[model samples]
Target: MNCVKTIVCIAAVMGASANTALAQHTFSMSSEVERVENPLLTNISPGGVTVLRFAPTYAFESRGERYRSRLSLSAVIERTSDTTLLANRDFPSAGYTWGYAWPSSDLELRANLSESATRNTQFADFGRVTVDAREREFLTGARWNKEMTERTRLTLNATNRRVDYDTPLLEDYRELLLSSRVTWDHSETEAYYFEPSHSRLTPLNGGAVSTQTRWLVGTTRALSQEWSLDAFGGQSRVKGAQTETGTLGGVRLNYTGSRLTSGLEWSRDVAPIGAVSRYVRNELLGVRVGYRLTEGTSVAGRYSQSRSTDVATGRGSLFALSLDNQLAARWTSSVGVEERRSSGFGGLSGRGWAVRAGLVYSYASGL
Candidate 1:
């Protein structure tokens, strides 16, 4: 998506909101700074780095009891100390969402459109990149839901996404997805769901075109007022130059209370490899817990384990931990450490560790 296009789309939505009655607007600004050792988390070369970031956002929301709509615009500016490894980046994102439901009825309709541009590097984007690349994406989607019976509900959704990259070496693709879900309410605290989806991935550079069809069965249950569990398991069939099928599923357990919130998850899936002709199978496990020390202060930490392999790249794992604190109403900071170790093609060899500290200040107000 082009920056101009995002701006124009946001402008159009804002203009349309003017005719709607009882609309509210909000504005927020946030600034952050981080100091890091081995910033990119790469196994090859590590260096000390500092990063600065600023983000400003504007949002307009409707205040209807049933019918609702929202338009939001966000922009980001980032600067890094070591341009040779990690360059400066900027991102501009805009989105419009609208939903409607009838009073005392069990039917709903929703739609969304978004455009965004980003320039950055992420270690989890499959591999480490020595240079920064720009990417743009456009998304449009719609969903409908209806009550099938007193104990059941059905929903259908469709989405289209386009991704473009400034680096011609990276593949650009358009994705179309269609899905349906059905949920059965066994009780106030127990529910089960069945979901099926179909997706088509078409490459713009004459690469292999892939299609996937998948189905999942899942359940959600409240163990208690403050504890819950969600679990799902499924399988997917992929068709392309090479046909492949694999198991795909995940499970999550969560806790919610007055002063504590935590979650644990495990997943396995087959995902399309970026700019590559094949797909990779990934297995991941993660858990996070946080406790509020006071109204304005909290402490949290997280750990995750992942292993992935494909025809082109080997398996790798990443471990990370952090301590976070909310100093005041609008001020927050965190100290973190992470290590990456791998022993495969395109994977990290020796273990590399990085320590980081960051502070963020944000202010928000109604417009």
Candidate 2:
């Protein structure tokens, strides 16, 4: 079957399979490219980077009265490049992920597994390069969510990770994390979610042991028809680690109107111990304006002004603008620009601009 037809079939089966006592399967695919106008190669220089990502996914959901099952599979490839690093240097990584969700009365069970492999080269000297090899990692986890009462809920999750490198210069590693959360929702508009998690990290050959204890709290409230707020705070203590304690807090104020949804947020976050997607203490004021230009097409403009007190080491100011046009019928297109300026601290600082334009084919009907 063709791609568009396949997508339509997959989405069509989702709702019915979830409600019926039958099982069903679905699939999806996506590709994306994000290029940097000027990348930072030596950690403090201007360079160019192009990141390409491709993903294919499959999902299955079933209902069996007292027993339920949901399965997901994903394959992804990620690659990054710098024309100056090695004249044509690039690193590619492939990863696969699987997830399962089941139901049992007031309790639900969930588990996920993932593995990834990476390969790349680095510049060491003016004429010398280090042939560091690929790195491979595996992760698996399970979680249990229980409804303690009509107003309260609790969850417990545990995960373990293992890592290996193709080069002996790099060593193996292992780690585990035990996390839990409890939430009390007075209603849809007002709620709080709290979490306490413990983690430990150690090298493959019993090299070093690092530990952490963390607590997080989240809250949401609707002030009025056009205004709402979301807030969260977290505290963590680390042992055998370079850092001692870290705390984080953030708040987002949102406004809605006939043609726009605007939000402003201020946040202070700590650096994760591992390679997780995160940023510094970021503050942002953003707006989204949507106009029904035509019966068949709609236009949206989004702009944001943000600042980052990179908790890791520096300060940065950024401005971003995105323009999107959607054919209420068949296609979607977007154009965006991002300009960044920062204080060159921690040896990582730059002033540059980047632009991107993309088009995506969508179903004639909503998915």
TM-score of each: 0.85, 0.64
Per-residue C-alpha lDDT of model 2 across residues 175-259, encoded as one tens digit per residue: 7889998989989778899988887777665454767788889988898888999999988776663557767677888887666
- Candidate 1, superposed: residue stretches over 4 Å from native: 1-24, 40-42, 103-122, 125-132, 277-279, 312-328, 333-335, 340-343, 350-367
Q: After superposition, how far is residue 204 of candidate 2 from its true place, in Å?
A: 5.2
lDDT of 2: 0.55
Q: Compared with the true structure, what per-residue lDDT tens digits does model 1 show for residues 259-302?
A: 99999998887765444634566676778888888776677777
Give the best candidate by TM-score. 1
Clashing pairs in 2: 39-47
Going through the candidates in the order shown, the clash numbers are 0, 1
Q: Candidate 2 — which residues are off by over 4 angstroms?
A: 1-35, 41-139, 161-175, 203-207, 256-258, 273-312, 342-348, 363-367
User: Against the unseen true structure, what C-alpha lDDT does each candidate score?
Assistant: 0.69, 0.55
For model 1 the TM-score comes to: 0.85
